[model samples]
Target: MSFEHEKQVCNLFHNSMEIIGRRWTGAILVSLMDGPKRFNEFHNMIPEISSRLLTERLKEIEDYGLVTRTVLSDRPIQVIYALTEKGAELQPILQLIGNWAARWDSKPNIEENTTEKVLNI
Candidate 1:
């Protein structure tokens, strides 16, 4: 490939990782991959996430054009979160990551509630 094209590709990959690497963003995208989910449903799905962080992640994804939030005209103004077309396209990538995780999952060396650290072998 040409130098300019290579640089462009690298930049796009860098930007994509920077955006997706944020806390809960990747999880939220993966959760919404199947279809729309309500706010409470997301909370239940990802029990570890705090409300503030959840709200922040949702807004961030929405701002990134990957998520579409629909407000239902119901008694309580229900909100549903769904992936946009671009977001849906990320399914393959997520699956690949999941596949890689499965490879290491069987030999997980980290204990629960422990901060991650690399073992220099």
Candidate 2:
């Protein structure tokens, strides 16, 4: 492939990573794979995430057109978040990553090994 084509591919990959590689973004997307969920539901699904961070991440993804935020008009108002088609397309990719991690991440820490090698060198 031409250098220009490789550069374009690298740029696209970087942009894609910037979106899904953010902390908690993948988990948030994975949680919504089931269906639309209310704010509290997200909190329950990802208990370690702070309410503040969750709200921020939701707004970020919503802005990126990856998610839709719907406000329900009930006695007590509720907001639901769901993945858009663009976001839903990531399901298979995310699943494949999950599978790969499950298979390899359980092994000895590659980072530690690399660090040791570097120190010895």
Best by lDDT: 2
Model 2 residue runs over 4 Å out of place are 107-121
- What are the per-residue Cα lDDT tens digits for candidate 2 across 1-121? 9999999999999998998989999889988888899999988878999999999999999998899999999969999999999999988888777655655675665454432232222
Q: Go through the candidates in order and give the C-alpha RMSD of each one to the true structure.
A: 6.8, 8.9
TM-score of model number 1: 0.82
Residue pairs clashing in model 1 are: none
Q: List TM-score per model, in order.
A: 0.82, 0.84
Residue lDDT tens for model 1, 1-84: 999999999999999988788887877887787679999988776889999999998998899889999999999899999999
Clash totals for all candidate models? 0, 0
Q: Which stretches of candidate 1 lie over 4 Å from their true place?
A: 105-121
